[model samples]
Target chain A: MTATVSYVPAPDAAPRSRMLGAQTRMELRLLLRNGEQVGLTLVVPLLLEVFLNLPLLSSLGGSRRIDFVVPSVLALAVMSSAFTGLAIGTGFERKYGVLKRLGATALPRSVLLLGKTLAVLLLEVLQVGLVCTLGLALGWHPHGNPIWTALLIVLGTLAFGGLGLLIAGTLRAEVTLAAANLIWLVLLFAGGIAIALDSYPAPFADVARYLPSAALSDGLHHVLQNGGGLPLGAALTLLVWSAVALPAATRWFSWE
Target chain B: MPPQATHAILAPSRPDEAASGPALEISGLIKSYAGRRVVDGLTLTLARGEIVALLGPNGAGKTTTIEISEGFRRPDAGTVRVLGLDPLRDAAALKPQIGVMLQDGVGAYTGAKARELLDLFAAYAAHPHDTAELLELVGLSDVAGTQVKRLSGGQRQRLSLALALVGRPALVFLDEPTAGMDPQARRGTWGLISQLRADGVSVVLTTHLLDEAEQLADTIVVINHGRVVATGSPAELVRAGAEGQIRFRAPAGLRLTSLSDALHAGASASEEAPGRYLITGERSPQLLASVAAWCAAQGVFAEDLAVERRTLEDVFLEMTGAELSA
Candidate 1:
């Protein structure tokens, strides 16, 4: 047996980030490997986008369905990854005592939350790319400034992700499950998706158009369908909503 | 099998400021759920390198106390110091110095491997134990690749222990660590705990099993109805509760009163059954010899003669006024 020569450094010199980075890497790897998260965040959204924009829906409404479905489905993708995925995932985590175990360690809570958020963001980005690719391939020309479109996507991600955290953190797993699914349904149907708020009677449309989910859909649709510039007001409104909801939700997220 | 060797590994590699102080000092700990007080006015201190078993029946404030000590719950009005740092106020600084294995209540159990969980926890500590070494120590080396949810109950318990030790904490808190395990599994856990002690890690464990406390604890604190009923070494608590009781079936024709009178001369005796009697005294030799002589003088033999020493169960029964099992 041969002993390998080892270099020994002076004691008390290693930076904490070296250790934290290693742990974060492992956490990221585990997260990417989860089948359900991948299915819900990536596969489901891609299928829904492609399926809704097929010749059947386009022929019925002359591409208006495709125009409406693109932005609304993006909303669905965000909801699935940020809210439903996190809520169900965190719920199961509480059930198994994973949060409690993590809390017991010296790892900063900020790092833990950040790691989870980053993983969700990575999936969200992938979702955006897939949806964009399908929209481009299906002869839907997005005639807006690429920079403005990028800004809208970022704002929408922040808003929905914040709302999702609020739901996952504050509500019980069962309640979060029901509420997230319910919210998704409401946004899909009544949130100015297939039917425009302007097409509605009067006051309801005026109010519904300002909702974060509705604003995101309207902003994205304006850019993709009408070659319109980014609606700075609606984007800011969504940003403000996220700023408020994200902090509150993150503050109250329960490990158990 | 002893406690000091592994503790040497668990002990901080760098100098610690609170080395001379108590391992844990908890004072006036109070926690309330809704309007009910769960833990109230509890104060206790654990010394360095000692194993203290907290024994209590269900809903006896053990969870609340342990949680507060671990910096998980804020006390309504109390102070808790782990390694001399206030657990709640200085949790970040104190956390690295302690290892806490809560009852596997938080979810981190996707299909990720056990080694992955260990690595994650090891990241939380300043100087985590080697991941492979920790897995082997916890008896999960063979199944390192198995997902956490796929592990059996005993295997999960072992994984939980490994996660807790990843930081090589100076003090380890184990809550009902061996609740459901076969004899072999239980013994394996005991061996690991023994190994931890040999390494110098102070362990505070809560268990309903008296035998576990008897076998593992250097000191036992029994709590009932949200208060500490008795605190001492296991043998002391038991010996203080009941100095060995002796029971025997005397001759059928013998008068119960006469037998009691004769046995009472040597020790306290009472007829517990039709022809059976129980005797208790401070000294075993004097008590047994007198019983034997009386039986011989009566030309009768005693049947089912049994002498029992004080046990942790007896102490728990005496303090709580409820059977340990019940």
Candidate 2:
């Protein structure tokens, strides 16, 4: 308000790092403000944690139901934040020309990708804390290194987030809208987030373990339910999936 | 609010800061989709502080040419320079130096507040325009906190203009910048653009409105079939097609042969109706005076005498051909 003038910057006046930081901050605000996104990313996971832990659904996870249901719910949280929420938001952004607008700015394309990824990761943390608070109240106990569980969370995020971008970037917004939700539902039971891989038949369990969702669910289960040593299988599967999907997303993403 | 005490950025602080150079230069630009050329061998240039209006029928490739210059699309064949650098090759370097306003409400973040979005864009520039004042300048202050999705079409157009100017660009590209604005807002926007030129920001805008181009542009480029049909000032282009017209009412049976003899070269007069006459010739006060003199000598009164000059619309329709685009 002091000394009024139109305040456009000369070329090279602002540093690139600040632009990326601002983008990340704006992306975070948008993600948090959307009511549907908030419900899916945080509320759904907490509801699922409480429901699956109820004595009525006890048979789904066996004697130590709290430990089992909590991990699965955490995995679902990761899936929701990284996959469904991010995909729908980005798909609509592309459809609405938000991406094209950003593409025209001085902000780098790589920075835009990093900025959105960071925002999702940041939201996933809030999701984890809220769900864990509810999990603890429901008598859920974590047995392993919280560190190992954290690794699975990050890896799970990349794998799912990568695929989200791939779909949102390549497909039509309506198609991406339908496909993201469908994929999330399909993976919830079959890929081991809700149905533990070990509960399935032997060959099917083997195949599920190869899924990023399964690897995340099982990895978090191993680390949090069994005192953690190392989640090697989960890490490797997630690493491979992340390596492929992230690059493919980068290759296929369109601005408009 | 009407910005009763608003200090505008319309006056760029460093009006003399811009050096003498072509803000944009394009030659032999070509673009095609599915083997159909959208922009074919198009050439155009914009100099510092100048406004070039690219007028065309739909599908004339004006948008395509602008996109290529903005680095949004790659030209299949051509050379383009923005501030003397390849727009495509040096996009990162060129981006901060140019501002672009896309057509049809393309770039708004519907969920974010209008002010918040502008602030975020301001962060991208080393010296962005004052965020709040920009909203005020564009008449968006009342809706600063409102979500983009809730904005009216005219408000969105104003916001788009604000976003385009936030980067303090040396050159700006606007695709139908004032399309949805009300008459007052359009006048305000034209005032802003006029000041943008005074601040030494070169501009290239595409529009279907010939009057807008005629009033605001220093040079008007008429394009058709993916190529430049004619390029000149609005006055020059209008004059190129036909001379001004003169109309009056007199006796129905006045012999035009003597009138033709009294007129200058290439001038013709015809009776459009019972008592109405039209004359097409070189437009001058003398021509109108001569018509009056002839009327007086013939002992007839010239009623409803009016002189009308050719307008940009005439030139546009003449060059582009009058046909409805699908």
Candidate 3:
């Protein structure tokens, strides 16, 4: 070995935007590759949409049942990917020390979170496309502007994504796994996604309206089903949830 | 590996920030967990291009110290500077310059293939080593398509090492870099680390292997009870206070005051056990000649006479009061 010491120069960090794009692309690929996530994010929502539209399961009792089923199933898909899927995957990542390892890298925490958000949004786009195509095949007729539905989906994603991170970051992996699944089931049955809010008693219906899932379902229902303008109350409910949950998650989230 | 290949793989992208200052500096660092002080007033410094190994028993605060240096944990007191900038406050700037190889190889996404994981980490830097070349360098090319979780323990470790070097970092903090590796792989890693130094990259590694520290480190810091018990180069440490010894198998009771008188001052001879004699003194040709002459006069041949020098392990055990491997 030569005694001559040649100093290697220090490397600069890649552009932050490029790093973010790479991270988002990697995350989306992993999400798509995971069989269980694919089942939850894509297959489960499609099956539910099909089963709910069946003649025996149709409680609305009309040719317009697909209208109600399509919007509500879209809301459910958002929750599945943004809340349930993100929570379980992130919890395990934390348990396995992946987040702690990334914490030491040049990648900033904001970039990590943004990359995950972008990935979730991208996955939601695919889910929405699948659900809408399945709805169209089932003879569904939609109404109102699509822009309002996009707004509702975006806000609903942020609200649910924040809560998912909050649960995943604060709880143990096993606990997060159970809690996230349990919450998904409860919201699916009672939060006005599969079942209309009016089907419940008046008091329970009023309270469920504030739940993020119910708010998203109600907003999407009004816009697509009733051909209404922006549902101010439902949108505000989701906005408030995001304002509270995102900051809280940011404050309390632990990398390890 | 050829020097040219090593140079191409590890060459830095720009000149260092401060060419003359130490690569890392820590002073009066204090950290506690659950009211128990783990790092108590610890201090250390590494000159540019020097490799320093932190040697300690389990729970001796080695990991905590390194984590503090890496900006993973905030010290309760004192400060740490990497590349002349605070580790925590300047982390955004410092992270790009320093590489960290964690103890458990926990950074990569387990579901991603080995090559994909390396490529992802490489994308974080402007000038990263080629992913294919890095996999080849770490002897992981055969398993490049294997998922991270499917790789063996040593393979995962090599992958972790490749991640740390992908960014062309100026300094690297490695925690037990060769743990769980076979002897041949361990030697290969040692050579790579030496090459890192020849490229003027500074390193701070923690190891339980005493011989590893002695062989690779420019300075060895022995920590016990969250404090530095001893710090010096390997040779300086072994030669500090411990003297060499000469042992032989001979008649037990044959050693009388005659041997003591025959030898020079500050030297002593004793029969530690039956048929075994021990002598402690500064070892030299004159000392050996005197002992041989004394044995000739006493009509006793020194059978199996062996000269021994104090090793770094002996120095470590003497200071830390704990087994090196513990």
Best by the DockQ measure? 3
The Cα RMSD in angstroms, rounded to one decimal, for candidate 1 relative to the true structure is 4.5
Candidate with more favorable, higher TM-score: 1 or 2: 2
Per-model TM-score versus the true fold = 0.88, 0.92, 0.94
Q: Which digits, one per residue and each the tens of the lDDT, describe model 3 over residues B1-326? A: 23354455454333465566799999999999999999999999999899999999988999999999999999999988888888889889888888889999746689989998888888888777778887888899999999998998999999999888888788999999999888999998998898889778899999999989999999999999899999999988999987888888887798558898888888888888998888888888877888899999988988999999988888888898899663
Fnat (0 to 1) per candidate? 0.33, 0.53, 0.59
Query: Which stretches of candidate 2 lie above 4 Å from their native place?
Result: A1-9, B1-20, B250-255, B272-276, B293-301, B323-326
Candidate 1: where are CA atoms >4 Å away? Answer: A1-36, A55-72, A193-199, A226-229, B1-17, B104-107, B252-266
Q: Give the lDDT of residue B191 in candidate 2.
A: 83
Write one digit per residue (lDDT tens) for candidate 3, span A152-203. 9999999999999999999999999999999999999999899988888999
Q: Candidate 1 versus the native: TM-score?
A: 0.88
Model 3 chain B, poorest ten-residue lDDT window? Answer: B6-15
lDDT of 3 at B239: 90
Residue B203 error for model 2, in Å?
A: 1.2
lDDT head-to-head 1 vs 3, winner: 3
Tens-digit lDDT track of model 2 for A163-243: 999999999999998999999999998999888777789999888789999999889888888877668998999999999
